[model samples]
Every structure is written in structure tokens, then in C-alpha cells.
Target: MSHPHSRRVRRGLIALAAVGGCALTTLVAVPASAAMTGSEKAADPASCPVAAEISQGYHDGHDGVDLAAPLGTPIFAAGPGTVTESGPASGYGQWIRIKHSDGAVTEYGHMNERFVNVGDTVTGGQRIASVGNEGQSTGPHLHFEVHRDGGTGFGDDPLAYMSERGVSLPCTP
Candidate 1:
């Protein structure tokens, strides 16, 4: 007759294997973009904040804010994240884009020089690029954009987001 102990052992092994499989899946299920170290996720934009106000301007059929600065003005990381894209992007001129762990991305465009390269991890205040007039710009100004999760395909209105941060914009009546 088959032993009851052996049946119990086989059942226990199957249960353990199932749990192990699930753990592996959980680890692998996380996207590479979302998998960030603790320090990277805790970045604050105010620390490496935009030190200048935006010049009134419009781009891509939307009103984008411009950070007016002298050429070669240090551009800091808006948030802790990895540089997924860097270099000239047609209308963007010389630009650097960081993808944060929260899926929010920041774009710094019209740069005179790029301090970081692609795949580089940067914290807030870390210099990523320099401001300049490039692409389709009117003058030396940094075109700043904050994009939401999976919203990197297009630009978002910085006015709305900046307003939420207690930055009031002048009403153009």
C-alpha cells in the first residue's frame, strides 16, 4: 500500500513550487522602467528646481512654458530618474528626457550642452543640460515639459501642473 507520508510530501512540494513560481513572476512582472532604487524614487523637483521663469511661448499647437536663461545655464534634473532619451530630437533641439519611477517624465529642451548621457541615473539638482536657443525657438530659453505616465508621446501643459504647485500664472485677459 502507498504510504500516507509520501502523499503528504508530494503535496507539500507542489505547494512550495507554486509559491516559488509566483514569487518569480512578481519579480519579473515589474517593468524595467518602474524598477528603481529607493534613493532614485525619492527625488524632489524643488531641490534641483527650475531656477528661472518661463518666457511666454507656444509649441506643438500648445502653450509651453519657457525657462529664460543665458546660454549654458545649468539645467538640473526635475526628478530622480534615468535618462531614457538624450540628444537632438528634431523640433526639440538638443534635449534630455528623464523617466521617473512613478512613470512621470520631464523634458528639457533647447540645450546648449548635455551633461548626462542616455541610461544615466540622475537625482534632483543634478545638472543634465545647459539652456540654449535651438530647434524652433525664438531665443535662448529652455522648453520645459512635465509628462504623465505613458504620456511621453506628447507634451503636457506645464501651466496646469505648475499652478497645482502654487505657482500662479498671469491671466491674459
Candidate 2:
């Protein structure tokens, strides 16, 4: 036989579990993404660029992230910035670099076509290029990099940088 105190505790636990289940159901029914407005969608990093999988991530020698997409897939700017460099590059084929107002620089490489040119002011999520198997790449992908000091050196981990900015890389479709 259960004690009175134990019975009360058990009843309370059951009630809490029922309430939690209802809350969980409600949460599952309403996806956060579905509720986002146009402005919020624009600010969403997923909408910023490369809505594909990460073929390669930042590593010791690899200072950028590789987003795998089909050839001709459009690539968008990661943030609002001025195009400082755009055109053929040594190991990047067609490359585009944008210098943001915060002194941070974003680079996109291995593109088949560059829509933006040097000195062009680009907004976040603007189409800047398309994926291609150009230069040193083995397949079609966008090699994306973020430099904190806006220098032509090894960049910091792009995933971390995006995360710090409340952005996530390789957004899913």
C-alpha cells in the first residue's frame, strides 16, 4: 500500500508529465522557422548564403569552410560589405572578397561566375557568385572564409565566426 504522501507525490508527477507532454506537442507543431518574418528571414544566416552541406570544414591548413553544391548554384553574400576584390585568383579560380564595415572580410572562391565586381557595395544575402569546380577544387563548392583583420592571410574558423554572429553555416534547404 502506498503512503498518503507518496500517493500525492505520484499524482503531482503524473500531472506535470501530462502538462509537459502537451507543451512538447505544441512546440513540435510550430516550427520556429515558419514563424520568421521577411526582415527576420533576411537577417537569418541560413538565408545569407550557401544553403547546402559542408563538404569540408576549417582545419589546420584549411582556413575556410567548403560548402558543397551543384554547379551553377547561386552563392550569396554572408553579410553587407564592399567588394574589394573580384576576378580570377591563383588557387581560387573566380574569387570575390568583401570587406565589411566592422573591418571583417568575407571571401568566396571557386565560383563559376562572379556577379559582383570590385568596389560594388553588396547587401547581406545578395547573389555574388555561383558554385564551380574551379582552381584547386576537386568538385563544385564554395570555399568561404572570414578574416577578422581584413588581411590576406589565413582566416579564422568560419563556423565559429558565423556562430558568434548568430549565424549558422551550410544552411539546410
Candidate 3:
């Protein structure tokens, strides 16, 4: 035979426990959600270097795809990386190479102007250069390439590589 006051007190304690449990769950869930949000930002799709369709696809002896944009169109870094090379080449005229954390390297060639220098760290989508008709290019365009082994090996199909990283560069089938 519990007293009325005792019953009221027990109900109050139960209610308080339920509220405390909810608060605890919310506290635990918030940090997890925050961590995921941070990861999403880090894993954001690599930016397309140029805002133009692929003028040329990977085939035959072509090592990279060309994006035909007006001369001086800004080119961005496809992903976060450190600039390993940024200088004139025999065939590329002006080129920039970035080594990513995954050991892959991205190359941008025929740039009218390069904004970054060797050993410089750049973030994904950072403006690194601009389109140009430098080197052996026929007209103004950006030559983009991806290397699987930090530019030591042959180039890979950049379209497929960018696609795997959730970037859909404008291109025709």
C-alpha cells in the first residue's frame, strides 16, 4: 500500500529518467552527425578544371582529354594536392602537376598562366591556371590528365577517374 505522495514521486522520477535518456541520445547523435558532415565536405566531388565539354576523349595515342574553352578561362584543381611540377615542358609549353594524397597525380597542360608554384599545397577547386593554346595545341584548350602512380606511369582515362570520384565532366558520348 504505497502512499499517494510516494506514487507521485515515483512517477516524477520515471518521467525525469525518460527525459534524461532522450537528452543523452541527442548528445551522442549530434557529434556523429557533425563528423559525417565534415567528411562530406572533405569528400566533395573534385572540381572540373574547366567549364567546357570534353573536346577530345581518351583514345588511340591520346594521353588526355582536351577541354576547349576560350583563352584565359579559369582552370581549377581537380582535388586537394601538392604541386609537384609547374613549368614549361617541351611539348606542353606550360604545365602543372599535383600529387594527391592517394598517390595519384593530376596534370594540367597548355595553361596560359599558372597561379601556383611547385611545393605549394592547393585545395580541391582552387584556381590554378587558365586555358591557352600553348605548346602543341591547335587552339585554346586545357589538356587534363590523371596518372595512377604519381605521374611516373602512363596516364589513365581521366573521364573514368573523375567519374569514380563523383565528378561528371561535361562530355559527349
Candidate 4:
């Protein structure tokens, strides 16, 4: 999409869609990356969103795990869901949020780039974005969070929750 004509056409379509009062959804077909494995099943919150091996961990009151990764490292989805939001959010920087069928919503923040868009269906362990230092981040790492029962805030301890679901966190304290 580096060509000027391509960009112009895209912009023109977007403007036309807006004037028509329609939500412009540009569907992007993404191939599965090597970073992902295993098919999604049951829509359970039992699987790890990121790969099990993490550099950092979780903390008390921290709703998600901070996984240290290099910039542009692909980040995968933890479970099957529909993407609800994917854009810049305060303190989240560039983020992608998915609402799972099991009454849970998961968010991945501080990404350098997002591959999917709103209304995209994502499976567990599917590549969704590339890790980056964005928003309220100190370095290049992914900030992952899960909110239960479709709530927006007041996230529970992801370490304990993941551990109970059989996914271990790197946190010791």
C-alpha cells in the first residue's frame, strides 16, 4: 500500500463510506505466523494469551502480565474471540481488545503494529500484533490484561487466574 494511488483510493473509499454513514471495515487477510500453535477450543480462559516463556511477570493489583519482548515480535491471542476495538487508548497506546464467548474480554497493549481490525475473528494463539513500547510503557514489552464478565475495568489478578487455569506466570511474589 505504499503507492500513492493505493492510498488515495483507500482514502476516497473511506470518505465515501463516512458520508454514507457506514462503518468502513477493510478486511485484511493475514496468514498464520510461526509464533502461533494449536487450534482454539472451548473458548475457555485456561490458555495463556502469550507464549508461556516470559521475561517479566505479574504483581498484586496488576491485572495482566508484562512480557518482555523485542520490538516487532508477534503477539498472539490467548483464546477465541471477536475483536471489538483496535486502536490508540490512553495508557494502552496501540491496543487490541477481544471479547470471548466465555464472558471475558482480553486486551493487548503497547503494540508496535496491529494485524487485525474491529470485527475480526481471532483464534487462541493467533498472531494479532507486534510487541512494542507504546503508551504508558517504560520499554519494549507487551501489557496483557483480562477483564472478567465483559467489564471494562477492575481487572483481577491475571497471574492467579492464569495459574488456576493451568497457565504459569513468571511472577514469584
Better of 2 and 4 by TM-score: 2
lDDT of 3 by residue, 32-118 (tens): 321224355456456777898778987647878899989999999998989999999878899999998667799999999999999
Ranking by lDDT: 3, 2, 4, 1
For model 2, the superposed segments whose C-alpha errors exceed 4 Å read 1-47
Per-residue error for 129 in candidate 1, Å, reads 0.9
Error of 2 at 158 (Å): 0.5
- At residue 142, candidate 2 shows an lDDT of 93
What stretches of model 1 exceed 4 Å from their correct place? 1-48, 57-60, 159-173
Ranking of candidates on TM-score, top first: 3, 2, 4, 1
- Candidate 4 C-alpha lDDT tens digits along 1-173: 35423423454566577698776635322233311233332335455555424655544446577887678877887677899999989997899988887667888899999999999998776889988899988888888777754746556556644554456664321
Cα-based lDDT for every prediction: 0.65, 0.76, 0.78, 0.69
Q: Which candidate leads in TM-score?
A: 3
Model 4: CA > 4 A from native: 1-47, 51-61, 170-173
Error of 3 at 10 (Å): 68
Of the two candidates 1 and 2, the one with more favorable TM-score, higher being better, is 2
Model 2 lowest lDDT segment of ten: 25-34
